[model samples]
Target: MAEIAVLGAQGQLGRQFLAVLGRRARGLGRAELDLGDADAIERTLRRLRPQVVINAAAFNDVDGAELRRQQALAVNAEGPAELARLARTLGYRLVHFSTDYVFGGDRLRRPRRESDAPAPVNFYGYSKLLGEEAVLGAGAAALVVRVAHLYGGPSWSAGRANLVERFLARARAGQPLVITRGQTLNPTSVRDLVPAVLALLRRRSAGLYHLTGSGPCAAAEFAREACRHAGLCAKIQWISRDPRPARRARYTPLANQRWSQEGLPPMPHWRSSLAEYLLSAQNLPIRD
Candidate 1:
């Protein structure tokens, strides 16, 4: 059995873990391991018997969740609860990913700490919040890391492309970009997040932690910065709100208070990580 097992291997973040963890880790995508299937999850894990299980799978469509509540709940809430149960019985550490959407009522623009009460505004956020509660309350060895605006990872599907990739593609194609304005988030880099997670595992850290880039910015501003770094000039139209049916919080910057207090390495500013990713070989084939 591999030392580590990563579920959701086909996802952007999951792919990063598979790539970074290399041979020591085994990846199980939806085809290999379905989170919604409790028996399958238990049977598979019992066979692998990995020392650590990292759950990266989730029904992440914020607006889509409004229409498909059951699908979202099954994958995001119920599935995680089962994983937590197995982690305790099987005696393996579990690392689960969560989101900033859990604190939807934060209109005051304060950086939310782990201790802050969660008030999800949309079904997607609500489902994830449920998952967080289930995992943490299960009395299992688990790490629930809440992140925001993840970028700089391999997109498993065309629709899964992150903010940085979307902006870069549009800019390279000489297309004007339309971005939301009021929503603020810490645009985290998968590259940076992967290492921080590894550090937490090395230290055997558990419980809830907000793991995101150092600071936050408006979505429009983040797009502009991405274009600037790529030496691309593109017209950007900003809108006050997203036209989607789902309600989104205007300000939800997650503060890495627990991570910092634990003496973990400080996460780089969002801009610094963005620049590094845009300039790196991962983002190549620049036209013009």
Candidate 2:
């Protein structure tokens, strides 16, 4: 068995983790491991007996979760809970990823700390919050990382692209982009996040932690920055409200306070990381 096992291997963050870990890790995609199947998860982990199990799989359709609550709960909440239990029984460390949507309806506009009380405004956030509680509540060595607006790596399964990629794609195609204005978050890159996660694993850090890019910005601002960095000019149509049915948190910038106190390396600012990502994304038709 490999030292590390990464679930959701086809995902943006999962792919990055596998690339970084190389031969030390074994990747399990949806066909090999289904998050909704508890018994299958147990059987797979028991057989693999990996020293570490990283659950990067999640039902991330924020708006779709409102319609498919059961699917969301099963994948996001119940799945992690089972993994946490197995980690204790199987003697493997578990690392679970969560989201910033776990914080909403907060009057405070600052970046949320690990100690902040979560008040998820949507079903997706609520489900992830339940997952975090379960993993941390289970008496196992687990690290629950809350990230926001992830934006590096290749397109995810089903051709779903990250925010930065979406913006760059549209800008390159000479299409006008319509983005929301009020919603804010720290646009984290999977490139930076994968290393930080490895560092946390090295430290054997347990419980909850917030890991994201340094700077926070609105969706429109993030899009504009992506275009600028890619050296593309495109018209942006900014709207004040989200047209989607699911409600989003207005200000949910996660602060890496605990990671900082642990003496981990600081994440780069969103702009710098965005610039680096655009430069590295050679497949995209990035203009000079």
Tens-digit lDDT string for candidate 2 (1-288) = 699999999888888899899999999999999999999999999999999999999999999999999999999999999999999999999999999999897489889999988999999999999999999999999999999999788764548888877788788888888876676889999989999988889989999999999978887788887887767886888777778989986788999999999887789999888878877746455474
| Window of ten residues with lowest summed lDDT in model 2 | 279-288
Candidate 1: list runs displaced more than 4 Å. 156-159
Q: What is the C-alpha RMSD of each candidate to the true structure, in Å?
A: 1.5, 1.6
**TM-scores of all predicted structures:** 0.96, 0.95
Q: List the residue pairs that clash in candidate 2.
A: none
Off by over 4 Å in 2: 156-158, 281-288
Model 1: number of clashes? 0
Residue 68 of candidate 1: its Cα lDDT?
98
Which pairs clash in model 1?
none
lDDT for residue 130 in candidate 1, whole number 0-100 = 97
| lDDT assessment of candidate 2 | 0.89
